[model samples]
Target: MTAPSEPTDASAPSPGSPNGPGTLAWRNAVFAVFFISGLGLASWVARIPAVRDSLRLDTALVGVLIFGLSAGSVLGLVVAVRLLARFGAPRAMTISVATSSIGLVVVGAGATLLESAPVVFAGLAAVGLGMGSLDVMMNVEGAAAERAIRKTLMPLMHACFSLGTVVGALLGAAASALSVSVFWHLTAIAVLVFLIAVVAVRSIPELENTAETSAPGEPASTWRSRLRASLSVWADPGVLLIGAIVLGMTFAEGSANDWIALASVDGHGFSNTAGAIVFGVFVAAMTVGRVIGGPVIDRFGRVPVLRACAVIGVLGLLLFILAPNDFALYAGTVLWGVGASLGFPVGMSAAADDTRNSAARVSAVAMIGYFAFLVGPPVLGLLGQNWGILNALYLIVALMALAGLAAPAARERHRR
Candidate 1:
């Protein structure tokens, strides 16, 4: 396999320059990947209720099943870097997208045909593995695309993901209302998204070819050496700190992904359709926040912006859990969405502050952030089983507060 190329600096070729088409193509490509990833993941999330009912599962069983996705994601992280090294980001993305699409098909089949919880869990694991690798590749591509544009575009790229989620959630709601079979809904959506992704990936520039300049006579790092280097990044204090901050942020976000809809139905008395709408509202709010976050981060800096977001998240969660009326619940969902928007993307940008080791550092942060999903499903399951789904969300409030305290770790270090 060919050695991975180094990433170019942000100053290399601004997309606004006369030679803009190439840079713009890459940016659009990354956005497409982000959108597809979000859509596929949310499509599955929207069906969680249907799947649970089909399998006759309780809250605890639902949580255990969701753990399959998390476990797959963790495993994906281990394999993705190597794939990126051998095949490049675009190719790796193609492979991952295909994997997720197939996994979704399997999940749908299991739900509709077999009604087997284990089969569904296996499918979710497959989806998670693909999603995990896709997450890393897309972020790596987004960072490279941001550099090419010479702008703070991470939030915008993430916003595309939220936009996709909105679309997926709405579609999922429609599917549920129509009583569409899980197999048909997901399989059809997967096919449509896979086609779009195929077209989008064609535009990704060869990012691996732009490696940093090396000293005279220094050999390019082999795959084994690259793997070793990636593992070593975990030891860096800054990276670890960034990872910790992101852990809280991801926990907040992932919890919503897995639980918000269920909470609305179980805690509040909404039907599945209404529950999905609430989830959609949350994603829409996140989309708005991410759409507007770029300028805020550029002007105020990542640390301050993230801190404010954490505070808003805490307020949102409290209101969501304690609100006495549906109106207040809806209001809290909006606050929660907006508040949770910036953390993951900003943390990614912070981890990639030094472009030379961006791919590896990003891998490290993503692994840490994803751990939340790994632990979230089962933990929240038990909590919900004992207390209540809405009450279980209070755990995220504490996490958001911790995220605020860790915000300073994301400050860009000034090299003398």
Candidate 2:
């Protein structure tokens, strides 16, 4: 590799530098942006009763409207390759934050202006699309930033996401208690998120210019070239398997995020507040797990960490399935959180290790994983409607098992 470029001030992280605290604090803040924005959909979730009462929608119809974010996300991931190639990291990051900020504004606005189901779906789609774009770019830059600092940073970055979720959950509760209109609350949060984006924009480096044999001022990938590159990444067997493993983990995580409260209420007979607390425990455990993930990944190999996480998740889900009361419910959620924490970050790192085409490869694997997230919860909802939420959880266990088994194969494929 060419000698590392002269340490440009934009890229350096100095201990005594005056900008140091801001940089370090913003690193965590950026992760929070990912986590909080992710759970932004959930922000209004607690307020759903208020919305339904205001809009006069029955439960069945309300269910269909929930698909906005996932649909937008899947669509965004499908096109993320071309998006990143065209805009590069800095501009791409800016656009995603800007778009998501708008999404937040719309979501808050929808609470007041859009009473019809279709209008609600439109608002959700905007959030999802913005989130989808933001997710890919953050991870892409996250991986690059970790490398520039010469350390294992993905886990900690993701841990901040978990931390952000915790904060978002609290923020939602506070907003609800204050009787803050969802519109005003989210709009305020969006402004904060936007300012955070602006401050961190400088810290995000350009993509590493991975073009091969550039023929005299070759341009970035157009749609055709981006498609070819995406195809090449997907064609790799290791990438394919890693994608599968991620699919399972994401499916499990999505179920927890989207369905766990409903399950606690409908299946386990907990109060709404109690059910929310159960979900909170799960997220908290995940945050703890991720905070410590960097050391775990550094000490042991990726496969071992992943396999262990899967096994724990399986146990966590089974515990929930078989347990008799609220105590078991909380414990199970905690176990699930701890178990599920490392899958995404470790999986992304593994994907990165597997392919030299880092951007395309990461995007390819993320596409499948996120696609599972889009499809998994709805399918589970269908099962819940048919056989009840308890039976639906069996699928989560099965998926976790698949993740555990894929670890060895994925790691071997990446072995040089």
Candidate 3:
């Protein structure tokens, strides 16, 4: 069955909806896949220190290695639409998860057994490719499911991702504490991800006429055509504004991921353990925000919630950057996490609101948001080198303000 051609009644999805009688199961399946995706990525990340030590790599080499992952992700996004065109949603999703899981295994083996940088780089690239494609596919599926049921579920779906990250990170820490090798640690994660992928793909509803990339009585669309369509979305003012929100909010979230601990240690005169705790607080707050954001949005509507989040996020950031006391610092961390929580998910949901071009729009917004991971790190690294890490964060404040101004763009656009 295809997705809903128009919005269903608010009470329940119509029997003809893609959800059908299995809506609950499908929603849970989507949740499972999102959780596994997060778990898979974090499991690899959590063992990065081990990979570095095993390979005897320096910081510069590590940076180059990560660049491989980022480059691969860009390549994956470039091909995502084509993948969907060729395989349809179910098979395409399987391919994506299989690619990422296999790459993860290769990463573990290369790091621990082969002790080879080139091999690990190849693995990381594979992981990135599979995951990048998987992200688009999953989000499309998620947006479809949420819309069918007339619910705001993206935040909770993202919350599952956050929960996965927490689980993976904690497991990795446990492995490290117990002297588990990178090979074993990541191999286990990869195997589980593969198993989950196998089960999850069976549940995603196939799109026959939905997503509007294919028209009836037409031959199959080519990758080139999909690529053109994806590129064309860049011209859409609404999509672009949503992308701006993703850009800013994603940068806020990414900045904390990369630097919160360092800032706490260097900028705030905290011990390494204390710095780690601060970073944990930020992550916890983010998870909390996502867990609660759906219900909050349901009550307040997207624009008001988004605007409030932007304001809270900026305030939290300011406190983290300029506050004079511990209370302000803790408050800022929580506020920052909560504030940054909904932007990416909400933008994605907004982009998919007009489902005729849902896949293309999602791909466009995702790539734009993904830019944060690619560029934010290096840019902030340079700025922090000269200006101090805490000072470098003010750039996020500006971006967050931009997101606030653009909140109206995410106001639900009824399907045309």
For residues 1-416, what per-residue lDDT tens digits would candidate 3 score against the true structure?
Answer: 00111121222232245546666667777898888887887677666656766887654466567666777777776677678768887788788888988898899899989999999999989988987777766766776778667777766777777877667666766776677888888889988988987887776667653333442222465878767766878889999999899899988987776567557766788654455456657777878888888778778889999899999999999999986977888889889988998898788778878765666777678777888766775577667767877898999999999999999999975422
Give one digit per residue, the lDDT tens place, for model 1 in 84-147. Answer: 7788766777898888899999999999998988889999999988988787677667766776
Error of 3 at 371 (Å): 1.9
lDDT of each: 0.81, 0.66, 0.75
TM-score of each: 0.88, 0.80, 0.77
lDDT for model 2: 0.66
Flag regions of model 2 displaced more than 4 Å: 1-42, 45-63, 78-92, 112-114, 177-181, 202-229, 232-236, 356-360, 412-416
Number of the top-ranking candidate, with lDDT as the measure: 1
What would the per-residue lDDT of candidate 2 be over residues 69-176, giving only the tens digit for each residue? 678777665455466678766677677777767877776677656655576667767767766767756765554455444566666666666766666656665665
After aligning candidate 2 to the native by TM-score, how far in Å is the CA of 274 from where it should be?
A: 3.2
Candidate 1's error at 260, in angstroms? 0.3
TM-score for candidate 1, please give it: 0.88
TM-score winner = 1
